[model samples]
Target chain A: MNPPILEIRHLDLQLGGFRLADFNLEVAGGECVALMGPSGCGKTTLLETICGLHRPAAGTIHLAGRDITHLPPGTRGIGLVPQDIALFPSLTVAEQLAFGPKLHRWPPGETRERVLSLAKALDLTSLLGRGLHGLSGGEARRVALGRALALRPRLLCLDEALSGLDETLHGEILAVIRDAIRREGVTALHVTHSSAEAAAIADRVVRMQARVPDAGERDLTANPPNGRWRHRSSGPPPGPEVGRC
Target chain B: MPSSPPAPSHPWRTRPELPFLLFLAAVLLGYLGLLVALVAANILTVSPAQALEVLRNPDIIHSIRLTFFTCTATAALSVLIATPIGYLLSRFRFPGRMLIDTLLDIPILLPPLVIGLSLLILFNRITPSSCCLVLGGTLALATLVGWLAVLPRSAPPAPAILTTLGLVSLTLLATAWFTRHSTASLETLAGDRFGLPMTFQPLGIVLAQLPVAAAFAIRTLRTTFDQISPRYEAVALTLGCNRGQAFTRVVLPLAGRGVLAAGTLAWARALGEFGPVLVFAGATRGRTEVLATSVFLEINIGNLPGAAAISLMMILLAVAVLLLVRLFAGNPPPSGQ
Candidate 1:
């Protein structure tokens, strides 16, 4: 059997006073895991760490059975859709979608094809030439998603990418994301507060709990724990499930 | 029927802060009125015919050309240096970061005469080797601080390179310092070997203008970089862009207006600089004289009308450049977008 697509072992991260210690997780190929946690619980931090935006204090991160702990973000084969939907303001929808492939030195023909397909899939064909300034929240979110997915990354991490949408639009974009992920066959780690969002798209929901440190703990002085795994909220445990959405 | 709330009163008449607002407006208008009066005086002192005659003077034309050339060079050089320093200040948090930031303000805060005197002393009295030693020491210290800050998170190979660079800089600094006694002053060396003496030369005018102009540019760019969110660069990195690519592709496009603003403001400031050019470059007609020094020379020779005319020209030129920048750049893009 193939090893898991993404794995973390004994991960320790310290950001200011907040920390995530002794953290462990594994995601098989083409699986989507939803991480639900309260604010200041290191959910975004964990996502950033996995994407190589932050270095771990102590741990190993393996992507497709290759050690990527010390790799730079550009070479990590990870894609991130940040909480703010950080679309490049200077770029048009088409340019934003093509950004990743262009940076990786893709041939113009293939890059154009990838951009056209992603724009079609994400319903951004009409808005491809429009700059980000005029994009609605939903449109911007789709652009961000398309930009990330354009590279066909091994792991896609979304931090609150679907917040602030009305119910109907939320459901529509959720379906779009689900379809895109399935089409690309990419592993995903999604951070969101909405359980309904988790239930609708994620194959497994993992709730993160804040773990306050004891006063005399040695690690507490160095790096206090902010959050740890509480339980699997739903879905089958550990192994990859067949036919995941 | 429910009782209606009290009807709103006239905003200007009923607002409690009206008096304070009026006072603020009065102060603002008073200052503006003073500036208007000064410009009027300069204009009224010189007729168009006299101003045209002064403008046609061969020496004055030379000053105009020299002023434009030197100020443009100063502003361009200012922006080039400020971009990297401003970005570093905005994005990183190394030891002595605050110190370095505060030190950058010294050029702007110091009296212009002092800057000129300092430059004069530096070029004329200090040996080239001693100057090199000082420059190298500062560079080595900065590199050491930066390397130490990144050591914890950087890859092993990067730290090795930084360490080696720091060591090399330090060694060069020590060697220069040991050999300082045998070296000639920078001014003498330039005059003897290169025929490019800095003091009392056209090059000295740019040197005098550079420090203050670059300081202002740095401040402008640092504020601009601060306003932009770092998340754009972070996302770019994850999308397969190295740090340099992320900065060029993501941050620079967003900072286009700020760069323009910094360059224009620096040029205007350089054009208006007077004391430093006077003290360092010596205002020789057709040689080291710039527009700012032209005004001083006109006054010294009792050409009051010529002085007024030149002053008005300077004011008009500065205003036109500023207006052009504002019209072209418009307002900065909304931060939210």
Candidate 2:
């Protein structure tokens, strides 16, 4: 198995007064981990924190064996496709896909080639010239996926990536995501509430709670001793401590 | 997109929208009738030759040019300032942000005369004596110095020397003009105690126009930026764009229609500004006169036909500007409040 490409320890965050304490997780390279939690459990907060959109109150985030707790999002080599599927309204599908490469100063020829290849892979060839607002929900979501993967990031963060799709569309997107992950072999941390979605795509699942349980309430803990994924079906452990697995 | 529910069985209750629509239409028609009557009365009262003569008057021609130039410059400066202010208000949260947002509305809400009075008081307190000369000399020196500083060090010395000579001559001419025109006004406002000539000067008109017009520009643009999802910017960032790159490449292009709308609205408002301009910059016949002021000037002189002629020009300017903006910047969808 590949080494862990993403490592989180003792993460503490308070978003709009909702506190997430001692949050810890890790994702091995090429592994797809689904983060499942109830609404308002800070699933998206963790994802945003990892990508540097929101600063953690405390804790360090290491990615690809490098400490990146204070790095800016653009330099972090991480891609995030938010739940809203926010395609730049002014850009065409092709331009949107080319955005990352262009920002990184990729040569014109190579950017074009990569855009065309991604468009084909995501079945967006005919829609490459279309404006973002004209795309359907499924189409826009797919374009967002293509955009996130355009940079070939070391870690991809998806926040409720398939939340709005119908069952068939969801399955289709799931298949496409699986194919892309298999092809790129990049680590992924996906946030969703759907257990079926987690089962469909994740190599392992991580659950977070709105409030870390008190020490006295501690029961079964999924956190193993070494900071690796451990499944627990019973009542939540008092809480997982930082680096205590 | 959903259609409204059917009204009640009673005819009056069933068609409530009809009365509302009719009431609004009547109010609109009332204003429309007033405009039509004004134009018709003016045209009938004056001969075509008399109107043409008024337009050809040196004072009238000069006023027209001054009006367009000052208003355009004010609108341009307001837009430049409003863009960043609007962006910051839309994108960031900070201590005092709410206070700043509320304060921005003060210019629009306050009477134009109040704003003008406040500016006069401010200048009086800060630089009452020799304000004109100090301001004029400082501006001239700064411009020339800035130009010289930007010249390439490795360029041929001959061109630089020639340009320096030209700049000096231009500065001297400007200084002479500022000294002659600004002195009398300063004496008038500050009375011999402190000759700070803001009243009855072109600069005074611009100063009066800036705040009121900038309020409209900022309001239009802030609403536009607020309506746009910040997610687009975040996505751009994830795509490897720095903050500046994201703003220029993604945010700016999307907000182009809004910027145009804001500029057009500010320009129109500046063109119509009279109260502030009158209070801050006295309606000096050939100097501080704009189309709006010319109307009042002609009216005060009992020249009804001349006033009508100036009012017609204002309407025409407004229509032309609105048309150009509509043609160039296609209308952005209105935000639901």
Candidate 3:
């Protein structure tokens, strides 16, 4: 009962036709969770609402114990790894790492030291001078991760963060991320449709069924659940982010 | 890894009307050469030094300097002010945006002289600002500053200066209008009638040019935006950078060259603005006499050599500026496009 690091309760995001109805989630401090759902099952909308990018039509989202429902994304200390790995093309790898702290007006010396350390840790020390013109998929993802980590966010939301990564690099990235999380005690909510990724990275997984209109839908809660799922007293934990729409 | 041999060149796969590029270049060069030859035939032969002596006449130099000073000042002012307007036009949608966009092009399409007349009719003897009595006084320098043309006969240089400066401003405005490259009959658009002192006055030239420069800058900025990728912005925002910081750190760097090109084009358009300056600022011998107006004067009033010499100087100055622009315009951060 460490204050829930992230929480979404009875959320209803009305995006025209589809409604993300009855969505409830919570992640404990220093814990990781995975959200497994189909393509259009409101996974992204949920994450965006958590990140304060989208406003829920009828719901409350508590992040780090603050009611951040109406806050802009920048005010909330949630880091998002979008699906497309939206790295700034105009910046060099090093500049990308410096982007966040520079905006927050951190001391230049500390920012520089942090950038160098992160570059070395991420194996981007040599690529410091490299411009972000045409990066291989893996390199871009790492740069993107470094950019997110620069903010030192309380929660890391990865929206299909590993989708574009090559298989060979995927294991390594996951391992790097796992180690970083353990070292920093940062909470993560990873979103993906891939079971292999869930099995590899998630401590626990929540199953999400597509929220179709309940005109004649069956009550899923009445039946014994088919797949293996561990339920929290409140609900499931937050997961990875979706690409910014 | 050894590089694979180059893939066989596509025979028909890559055809994209590219052959027309060289044809376009050739046609442009040939036309330019023909124009140069025509100018050469029209002028009396004179050495560069003799031409310099003729130019050394205080009267001629004064006229030339007035043209240079006014046009340069007007153009510079127009460009600096127009950038934000241009950026807004391309990026944002608001009420009256379309009307303002259309209104900006009027001075450019109409002859500079007509604009000057309209501006004059609006301002002095009628416009409230003109009722202030400052414009009508002899010390107002109406010929030089140009809002009041009621004293058109007091100075030999007032009308001509008004026409030249007016035309320069109008053309600057026109260049801005055309830069958008919209197929909307850009010229046929009329503006709100404030009956301001801009028309029929040298100020009209400045006024005329201001909107045109804005239009061109808008077009330039639009093209710049088209080449940018939002991925960079996405990255910065996710990294805790706000919109302003992200724009400065990410968008501007990659768009630097394009931005530079826009500014340079705007400046060049300002410098060479002629038709509007001719009609609005007028072809006065010493008042609003820009290079183009001087050329016009020499051709019409027996100073062919002076006109040719001034034209040549203008060409050299323009080439120098064009060269400077090219040199610096190639270094912006790589576009994700």
Candidate 4:
């Protein structure tokens, strides 16, 4: 059996005031995992840490079965589309799609072919030579996806990539993403606030809660504090901590 | 409240940009009033007979010709110097960049008299004014030693013009060659980099204005690029631009207007700079004399009518040049573009 492409073990990251602690995640190859958390909950931080844009205070990242916690983002073969879709200003659609592959010394003809196919799929065939400044939000998001997938990366970490899309375009984008993940078979970690997103595509769901103020070294003890909880089909209410997001 | 002054009603007060307009008006009136008063006084003093006499003076004609000739040459040289320097400062980061920026402002802020003295110190210090008696004293005043004590460009200059220009040209040629070689190697080893091509290099007069003009260019471009949503670049990168391709194609196009404005404004400033010309090149009548020197000498000689004529001419020329620049730089953009 082929192994899972990405594995995260108890990732812990602290940056000034915000902290992501007791973080554990795993995505089987060809699997899409949607990360959910409240505002200021470090969902994006977790993505950045995995993609090597940030560091986890304590964590282990295994990509394609090789540990890559300390590797630079460029060397890790992990592609990220930040929430803002950080594209370089001076490059065009086609050039944007080729950035990483060129960095890794991909052959020109193959890179060009890959870019063309990717462009065709993203409805960007007409937009290949066009500069990116004038594109609509939905169009920009699609281009971001194309660039990430162009490298044929083993892992794609998307951080709230649809924050600015309209409802109709959002559905179209979601569909495109589903088809893209299947066609590419890359392990994907998608962060969003919507549970509908997780239910739509995730093979398994893992819920994360923001660290509470003054909580010392993770309160792993179960049933220590008596708490009134709301029912969830006969389960206790997720209460303040778990359901807040 | 005793019958307020009808809320100071005017179309200007109610306009969306009214406050800014009023602020600009007050500043303009305050600073320009003295200059306007002086011009009015000169015009009042000019009689028809005196004006005709002033117009016929040969010395006045010579001074006017000399001043403009200097301004044009100096401006051309300044522009030649500023372009690459601006590009380098803006696009690259290296040691002493801040110091270079500060050094440039020295000429901009220093008084003309101090500038002249600085030039003297730079050149004549080595020649020891005693040697001025020999070598025809013409060579002494016409070149480095003269400007060293009296100019900004030559002051603190590391080498004389002869030595400096030849060395700078060689360095520029070598750099161009090196850049070409590296680009070729990179394309062979790692193809399709988007970094800017070497053909954009500035020349001659443009190079002379490299410091201030380039500084302005870099600031304009950097700010423009910064304001652009980098999300676009990231998206394009993900699409496939490789770092080089992404920037050239995506980011630069997005910032094209800003780049154009920066280039034009730098060119305009390079065209106007005067102090450096006077000290570095001297008022050698038609060689280094520019608009400011032409006006200065004519006014100082008590030839009010002649001075007014040339002053009006210089101002008109400046206006024409600025109009051409504005076609590219646009209406000052309210943000000093």
Candidate 5:
């Protein structure tokens, strides 16, 4: 049997005062997992660590049976739609969609085809020529999703990518994302605060509990093991657990 | 009948903070009035015809040309050097990072005469061969530090180690050759090799203007990068762009206005540079003289009118350039139809 598309074991990370400890997760090929937790529970930090923006304090991340714990983000074959919908302000909708393929050096014809198809899929064909400055919230979110999916990454991570949308737009975007994930045949790890959204899209929902650090863990927070800044937890660390929806 | 209600006090009179607010306004306007008065005095000191006559002088024309050339070169060089340094400072935190940042600000904070004196002393004390040796030694030290820093990281350490070793060896060999063969001051070498000596030369003017101007540019660029959300670059990285590609493709385009602002500010700073150029390049007519030194030289010759005329010209030129930059920055081209 093929190994899981992405596997994390004993993952530990600390950013500022927040920490994630002993976190473990697995997503099979073409599976979508929604990570639900309260605010400041290190959900976004987990996504960042997986995407190579931040290095893990300990543990390993495997993609397609290969250890990618130390690899750079570009070579990790992961795509991210950040919480802010970080669409490149300088790029038009078409350019945004084409960015990843161009960087990966796809031939012009194939790139154009992929862009056209993705624009059609995302309903961005009419807005392709438009810049990000004037894009509505929903439009910008679509652009961000399309840009991420354009590269056909092995793993796609979304950090609250569909939040703050009206019900109709939210449902529309959720459907678009689900279709794209199925058609593209990529695994996904989505961080969200809404259970409804998670249930509507995810194959399984994994709820995270805020883990209060014990006295022994308090020492680690005061003086971290590595050169990382001491994690001064205002409340508690998010200890993620695996559960079937 | 009930007594008529007392007339309401005027709002301005009833406000308790009115006097203090008026005082603040007075102070602000007084400062502005002083600047306006100074400019008016300079302008009224020279008749329009006299100012035009000053512009027609060959010496004055030479100074103007020299000023434009040197400041443009300085600003360009500043931007070139500042971009990478600024980016590194903005994006990374390494050991001694704070020290390096503070060191970068010395050029800006030091007295201009002190900077000039330091440069003069350095050029005089160091020969070309010795300079090469010092530079090579610095590179070797940097390579050692880089090797140590990267060794523990997950990155393939061998490639970085090998490349830096190769560069260090090459530099050491060059340094050895230079030490064995040549023993000439850098200024003399420059004069012979490029026909432009460092001391009392137009090139010296650029060197004098460079340090402070580059400091300003670095500050501007660093702030600009800080203001931009790093998530843009992070997103680019996830989309298959390596660090350099991410920076060039995402961060740079977003920093367009800030870059322009940096260059313009540096250019303006270089244009008004006086003490360093005067001390290092010397105010020689038809040679190293720039607008700032032209004003000085006119005053030295007891020509206050000519000095005021030149100062006025400088002010106008600086204003025009600033306005032009504002216009360009304010109306960025439509990103798309």
Candidate 6:
């Protein structure tokens, strides 16, 4: 059997006072896993660490069966769609989509074709010429997703993928996301707080608990049990059965 | 009750406040007019031809060249240095970050002459290499300590405090030991070591202007960096940009206008830097004499027309710079509230 597309073992990451320890997970090739946790849990941090933004204090991260623990984000072959939909304000949607491909030294024609295909997929065809500043939140999110998918990444990490949207729009975007992931055949690790979001697009679900207690909790100074809070599998994914639009 | 006849309109309630606004406007205009009138009076006393003649004077021309070039250099250097410093202050959260930020503002609040004097004293007492050594050592040590404190788990408070004190003492000792051999003043040392005159040299003028100019640049760029969302850089990173590429492609392009605006403001401030220049770089006939000191020299020598000509030149230059900055930066967007 092929090794998992993205594998993390015994990951320990600390940013400031917050600590995420002994994290272990694996996603098989082309699998979509939903990581749901409460606020202040290490969901975003783990996504970042996998993307090579944060260095793990301990443990190894493997992509395509190769250790990429010390690799820079640019070389990680992992695309990230952050919660804020951080579209580059200075670039048109077309330029934004082309950015990754161009950086990877793709030929002009190929880059343009890829950008156009992604734009079409994400319903960003009309807004390709528009700067990000004037985009509506929904449009911005779509463009951001398109940008992340432009490089045809081996792994895609989504932080709060269905957040800050109305319920109606959420279902629409999730359908688009599911279709795109299937088309690209990319492994995905989606982080969201909503259980419905987890059920809609994931083949499996996992949960991480906050290692540090919330502010004003009794055990402020006390270390977390066994140097980890929780890394429990929350059962199988429902796979887009939750009121698909 | 007939709604009390709809209530008679009070004068204050019905008024447009035009009179009050006009009064404030008059005060504002009067203050501006006072400056214009003074400059105008000076221009009036000197004919166009006389001003042209003053401009043609070799000494005055030299001063103008020195002023323009040094101020430009100061602005460029400051902006170059401030970009990374401002970025770090805006993006990173380390211990004593606030303290570093407050220290950046010291030159701005300091009297200009004091800034010059401080530089003068520093150069006089400490060799440049010595100064650099002490500063570099402290920074490297502090960063090492900071990293060790945070990473591998936070260190206990007692060791951290003791480590900080130890580093500080070591730095002080190093600085003192380095300065011990430098008995000669900056002027004498420069003449002996480099055979370049320190006082009244154009280089001294740049050194004097740097503190004030860099303070302004740092502050302006810090505000610019603060206004920029860090997520833009993050997006760039995830889009296959390394740190340098992310800054150059994403952050720099977004901040282009702010950088231009900050450079213009710093250049203007440096152009008008008089007190520091006077203290560090003395006013000589041709060398080290800038437009500000030229005006001072002319006034001292009872050359009213000459001073007036220089004043008019400065005003014209200031207006030109303002126009250029407006053209490039587009009014700076009212800064973040």
Best by TM-score: 1
- Write one digit per residue (lDDT tens) for candidate 4, span A191-231: 88777666665554455553333445444223212211111
Clashing pairs in 6: A200-A240
Name the TM-score of candidate 2. 0.75
Distance from true location, Cα of B71 in model 3, Å: 5.4
Q: Which 10-residue window in model 3 chain B sums to the lowest lDDT? A: B183-192
**What residue runs in model 4 are displaced by over 4 Å at the alpha carbon?**
A1-3, A8-24, A38-42, A52-60, A67-72, A86-109, A126-135, A201-210, A215-245, B1-218, B229-256, B300-337
Count the clashes in each prediction.
0, 4, 43, 82, 0, 1
Ranked by TM-score, the better of candidates 3 and 6 is 6
Write down the C-alpha DockQ for each prediction. 0.60, 0.32, 0.25, 0.22, 0.49, 0.37
lDDT of each: 0.85, 0.77, 0.64, 0.59, 0.82, 0.79
- DockQ measured for candidate 1: 0.60
lDDT by residue for model 3 (B148-228), tens? 532432332235445654565555545544544432221112223343333334454555445455456556666675556
DockQ computed for model 3 against the true two-chain complex using alpha carbons: 0.25
* lDDT tens readout by residue for model 5, A119-201: 99889999999988778888888889899999888999998898788889898888888888888888899899887778777
Clashing pairs in 2: A218-A238, A223-A245, A224-A245, B186-B197
lDDT of 6 at A119: 86
For model 1, residues A53-164, the per-residue Cα lDDT tens digits are 8888888999999999989998999989988887888788999999999989999999999999999989999999998777887888899999999889999999988988
Candidate 2 lDDT score at position A139 = 88
Candidate 3 similarity to native, TM-score: 0.64
Models sorted by DockQ, best on top: 1, 5, 6, 2, 3, 4
Candidate 2, residues A117-171: lDDT per residue as tens digits?
Answer: 9999999999999986668778888899999999999998988889879989899
lDDT (Cα, tens digit) per residue for candidate 4, span B62-141: 64565444334444444345434443444443334576667656655666446544544443343322222333333323
List, residue by residue over B1-337, the lDDT tens digit for candidate 2. 9999876786644465789878888999999999889778867877787789889989999899998898888889888989988988888653345767998989988988898787766565443234544555654565465456545422222244446545665665565555554433333555555544665688788888999889999998897788777777777777777778888887888788888888888888899998889987879999999888999999999998888877777878888888866764565632210
lDDT of 1: 0.85
The TM-score that candidate 1 achieves is 0.89
In model 6 chain B, the worst 10-residue window by lDDT is: B328-337
TM-score (chain A only) of candidate 2:
0.85
